[model samples]
Target: MSAVPLATPTVPRKRRSEAELKAIVDDFNATLAADPEHEPTADEVAAWAAFHFDGTLAVACSMADAVLPHVVSRFAPGVDVLFLETGYHFSDTIVTRDIVAEDLPITLVNVMPELTVAEQDEKFGPRLYERDPALCCQMRKVEPLARTLPLYEAWVTGVRRDEGPTRADTPLVTWDAKNGLVKINPLAAWSFDELLAYAGEHRVEVNSLLSDGYPSIGCEPCTRRVEPGEDPRAGRWAGFAKTECGLHT
Candidate 1:
């Protein structure tokens, strides 16, 4: 039999302890509480995150657009942008991500689940999303992000207050106890009109689905088209009781 290859050793990166991180979170939350209505500019938010978590900061993008990555890169060039490769994305979403990676100044890191799609199907049975979207999302999106987020002290997200009722009260900066990291929502106060204007001004790449009646895009199987008057997020998880895939909450 052929000799088994030796396992590659990994040098652990220095990370803040739970106590230290909790202290920082408490301080930051105090500051946020004092000025609860303070809405910092996107650039200012980026600067604050970079100042505190310079070497251990990351941005999580849903691949719906490159707007957040574009804004963060202004302050932290070459920073890591994590994309959850759930193996169920639309073709346009993947293309948008690839284009952003090729054209932008940031490093695109494709975070993936432990099992491949076929393996998951074999283990959990086919059409897992149809039968149990929450479980599928837990294995594909939530668990993968949980595994990857430990490497960073802070992360930026693209959530906006205008998205829907569920995200209406999104904070600019908050501690994510579930993932044990500081979460930053720089565009928490931005409107859809503002987002579009910024994208036009910056010439940022957006997924084609946005123009096809899908203002909020997710995994293809659960997404559908929405009417003009409906909520932007209504297209996601259509006819289901699921509002989110458990990434934010």
Candidate 2:
């Protein structure tokens, strides 16, 4: 089958007021709550995002898979995809990112931290993630994203409820109080198997680590392999008490 042409986005930059954003969030959350069992089709999810955020919609891809960007490109081609390049990813992660950028119609924006790994190590001592994973994540992931998130009114993520207990209540759409912006998780109801199935069905690019037992890929130093029956995220910060990289928490 021939690939569909990406639609050209014509919506101008339209930043909403605080009250307007709040109203949208409230209404959207209520709608989801009313139909808790309802899982919107990818096309429907893309349509809703286009209707609400329009040109300001950005997809947050972990480079674990290109599923989210593939869905977004149908409605908003050339949309910004926020990729946090924490300077600690595996070679496969970077390769996956490049593959997605080349294959997808979206724009890949590499969000970087204020300091390099060398600078950070020099300032905070070596291997911060080992000593304080939360603070390391704050410096590399959370802080950088928080700075760049203001450019877009709404951001979409690949987070799923089945990933872990902390993410069990993942919503399709909600107000991100931490970043003070509208957050969208279209695949919140999807399971790990569903994600892989979608990728296979759509021929989306997936990280190589997934087949190697790293269900949830993060930085090389912080991420490890998970054994059978372990939570998908168990490999992340394995020894530490940190389940999340603070991007979602």
Candidate 3:
């Protein structure tokens, strides 16, 4: 057979201005206000967003076990769910990822850091997470996310007011200055108990590790089990003088 042409990758175009973004939010809010119980269908939301934004929407799957069903059940299939695969996750975390991906009706897009573990170690030296967390995070999390952010109009997150200080004021909708795209926090006001209740009510699959003192899970080397009365995310990047992996920060 003759050689077939490979398809060219499509780079996302520039995003709308702040004024345009504000208008879109205003319109969305109006729609929600007019019919609180009659929320726009996920397909409808995705379609509406496509007209305005030009970047890939992402969600940290850390606690998504509680919300993935609602997002999948409501949104269109093939709606991208970008998972940052930072190459340092625990085995259980990977297993959980497999379980979630197997069941969800989303187009799971696994985003990875540009370098491999060995390569990263070679370049930056081993255990760089202990030495320079912010730089390490920039290499592993921020840069990878920035690479893909321009592919969708908005990104969704599972952040909640209960997560703690940094995320306490996370708006239901806001502009992410760093990524320059609309960020949607559908579960902003949801309490941890509320999330648990929803998961129980829906029989959603959760990370097995969650029951084992790991309220927040991330790369294996950085994460640990939290103590009682500690923040749920305390286990993540523990003792590294860091909290968020730059998704929210």
Candidate topping TM-score: 2
Which digits, one per residue and each the tens of the lDDT, describe model 1 over residues 1-249? 111112110223588887777777677678778987875788888888878777788888988888999999888887788888889999999899889888888877888898899999999999899999999999999998898888788889999999999999998888888998889999999998888889999999989988888889999998999898999988888878888999998
* Cα lDDT for residue 89, candidate 2: 96
Instruction: Give Cα-based local distance difference scores for all models.
Output: 0.84, 0.85, 0.67
TM-score to native of every candidate shown: 0.91, 0.92, 0.80
User: Model 2 TM-score?
Assistant: 0.92
**lDDT tens readout by residue for model 2, 1-249:** 111112122344767877888798898768867997876766787778878887888888889889999988878888888788899999999899888888888878888888999999999999998899889899999998888887778889988989999999987888888888898888887889998999999999999899999999999999999999998999999988788988898
TM-score of structure candidate 3: 0.80
RMSD of each: 5.0, 4.3, 5.3
For candidate 3, give the lDDT.
0.67
Lowest summed lDDT window (length 10), candidate 2: 1-10
Best of the two (2, 3) by lDDT = 2
Comparing 1 with 3 on TM-score, the higher-scoring candidate is 1
- Residue 155's lDDT within candidate 1 is 84
